[model samples]
Target: MEDGDLLSRALDFYGLPKKFDANLVRSRFRELSRKYHPDSGEYETDILFKELVQLRDVLLSSLQNDPFAILENSKEDPEGFQFYKSAKQKAAQAIEKYFQFTDGNPVYLKKEDNPALLRLRQELETAKNGLEEFLEKFPKSIWKEDTETTLKKISVWFKD
Candidate 1:
């Protein structure tokens, strides 16, 4: 395929705009590779492009999987808020339940001790992580303040 076609395909895989600055990609990637790569300059353009694709994948995934991004994306209307708000709330509740069930317990413990509770805790942590990330990207999201407030409750654990 042509370079443009390949670039477009890469963009599509990462859910990015097809039209990006070619020179910027060249420069940014060159800089990034220098930092990330052990033997940087020896790589080919195809390799560079592959790295670019990987970068795009990471950035896109981070944003897409981000709960804040989800909220921001859905902010065009009221109904969008309903789904995001519910998810944010659910995540908060799950985290709370997780904390309650695991109160004063060792963090390194295995899930087999209480399989159902452990599973619930895992899900709750996952939801909270997603919500936290989502809130970061969509600070002005409909349920953002509530999400932040909920996040603060969880934050206390790591402090002590």
Candidate 2:
């Protein structure tokens, strides 16, 4: 699945001057770690402090490198706009039948009445309601105006 807004948003996330790609992200994180290292002698920084800070930056960059990183970045980026857009397009295709609804929807309830079904149902309801609430509370979400439309519909389908 490919998102229309992913490249733009990922670029912004890494504070890159240009568009996002695999190599630039690695370079950016490396630059950040190098500049902020405690051994740079710019300040009296502690080893633990530098390590912790740099570790987080490295991990975040690693997420970007992963093929699934775009999905991970979407949650933290904004209203999950880019992620949802790509997902919607993929879900609409007939070839995606092998992939389950990873968003944790309650579609399985129609097939069985097991305890797991109830739990998933609850989760699906929560995600849906949360999206609805988020949209109402945070109008005009960052980066996109219609961010709530798709999510709201997804959520409504889970209403119980």
Candidate 3:
């Protein structure tokens, strides 16, 4: 099936409305999972449960990159969306790297200077710069507010 079809099927399978939030999707998935889970004894087989897992992953991944995206008739700006998604991934990875090295406590980042942390910081700076550029390039993008909000949060950690 096509990507769009997969998303639509997932929504239908979970009995979710076209316009729904991540929490709603997750909640519905959990409830259904309990019913279809192989170990739940509610279903004799795992086939339906496995399918549910895949559908849940597809929906969650879609939400992660594009929260505003819906199976609507209007088309989205693919180029801008791809760029924003890439930049968002970079920023998220940088944050994860920093946290991994810092043991989730950012206070140590200010006191210590290590090669790994320095590299992670540079990567984050690049992601931050990319996001700023995205705002300029896609001035009318639907993701503008989200990109700006992400930049603001990143700034909080890098303020000098």
Candidate 4:
């Protein structure tokens, strides 16, 4: 089976959003695992348990390489901390657009080098530039590390 297919199936099985963090995946898996575990005397124990493990592994692995996963817990805005938030949000939206096209599985998009992918890359670059602008404007901002980390994460996609 294709990785995307597996990922989609995993997402469906876990009842998770396309954009999820490792903690969410793990927590959900554990919740389901408790119910489906063979030791719990659930029906179709072996197959269901195995499938859950596989899907959990797939999601966890995919998230590790997922550039946009950085955005999952990045809404840490305090009062008057909107500096460059729009730029970060722009990059996030660009990522979401790509994921939307690919049904949340980047593997599908990575296989094709069409105009859509090119545009996505361009959009990502623009977002990166925005983040750079933020950094330039606020060199001593409290969010400097986060801004830099976000820039580096977005750059990861271009490397591929």
Candidate 5:
């Protein structure tokens, strides 16, 4: 079976989100492993238990490596990295816009809430947090420099 098919099946089996969440995946794995372990006696020498072990290994290995790096290094697809690069660029643009909207100011104005500004502030925080999560997940990403630069600019906006 293809890698994508395997990944899809694994995600479905574990009830994991489509997006990779290391902590969530690990937690789920622990829970399932405890129940399905060979010594757990939950099932007696079954294919399902073996399948779970295999699935866990595959998912963990995939998460441990930089999938983008694999694509970039593949001889079959010379330009495979383009898709990921474009995605990073788009995410960066959204983050930049969020920072621009905040303009280095607090969301509150004169101790009264401006609903519109408050909404924008929330959006900005979400965008920043998303980018931060991405950075943590893909530490060796090609977009690291740009992402870090944007994060630094956003941080300056919050200075007291």
Candidate 6:
């Protein structure tokens, strides 16, 4: 196959466009990896698997070197991009509130469900849910990594 054809095929395998989309690529990789991992008992040593790895590597390299490319591609899907951006902002605000409530200290011990704590928890949950919704709506969002990072921080705070 021609180089361009191979690239196109690779992108198709991951359900991505010619332009890079880190979030969608990673999400699809995770799904396929789970199914084809050596320990998954369904490993395939065919060209398809090789193509998957090549596409993943190319996308990952692009992400590391020029992450802004993903943002450029987002212009093609403005509505979804806008939703992702808005949801991410909302989540960030909620996370800030959470930190304020805890006074920047780690709540090592789980406290009783007091009214204030309950209210704070609700706010955090709302933010997390919003981010989750964005992920569902725009699996290929350029802000996916940021969203996931924020979610992880929220999870850590909840453990307090």
Q: Write the per-residue lDDT of candidate 3 for residues 1-160, one digit (tens) a residue.
A: 8988998999899998776656778898889989999998499999999999999998888765444344222234444776676678878988787778768553534425444656776877867877887787778989999999999888766643
Name the regions of candidate 5 deviating beyond 4 angstroms: 65-160
* Most accurate candidate by lDDT: 3
- Ranking of all candidate structures by their lDDT, best first: 3, 4, 6, 5, 1, 2
Model 4: per-residue Cα lDDT over 1-160, one tens digit each: 9999999999999999887767789899889988788887466557898899999999987854453434423555332145466567778888898778868543424526544677778888867876776677568888888989999888777754
Output candidate 6 Cα RMSD.
Answer: 12.9
- How many collisions per candidate? 2, 0, 0, 0, 0, 0
lDDT of 5 by residue, 1-160 (tens): 9988998899888888765545667798888877777787486665777787788777877754433433333354333334344334444554566557767665554214444444444544544664565566667767667777766765543443
For model 4, the stretches where C-alpha displacement exceeds 4 angstroms are 69-160
- Which one wins by TM-score: 2 or 5? 5
lDDT digits (tens) for residues 23-80 of candidate 6: 7788889888776666562775555566678878866665544333455346677546
Q: What's every prediction's RMSD, in angstroms? A: 13.1, 12.3, 7.9, 10.8, 13.0, 12.9
Model 6 weakest lDDT span, ten residues long: 64-73
* Higher-TM-score candidate of 3 and 6: 3
Estimated TM-score per prediction? Answer: 0.34, 0.30, 0.49, 0.49, 0.40, 0.41
lDDT value, candidate 6, whole model: 0.65
Segments of candidate 1 deviating more than 4 angstroms = 1-72, 78-80, 92-114, 154-160
**Candidate 1 per-residue C-alpha lDDT over 1-160 given as tens digits, one digit per residue, 9 for 90 to 100:** 7644654665654445533333334555556666555465555445655666576554444433444534444534543454455456566666567668779675543445545465565555665676666665556767777776766765543332
What TM-score does prediction 4 earn? 0.49
Residue 106 displacement (Å), model 6: 6.2
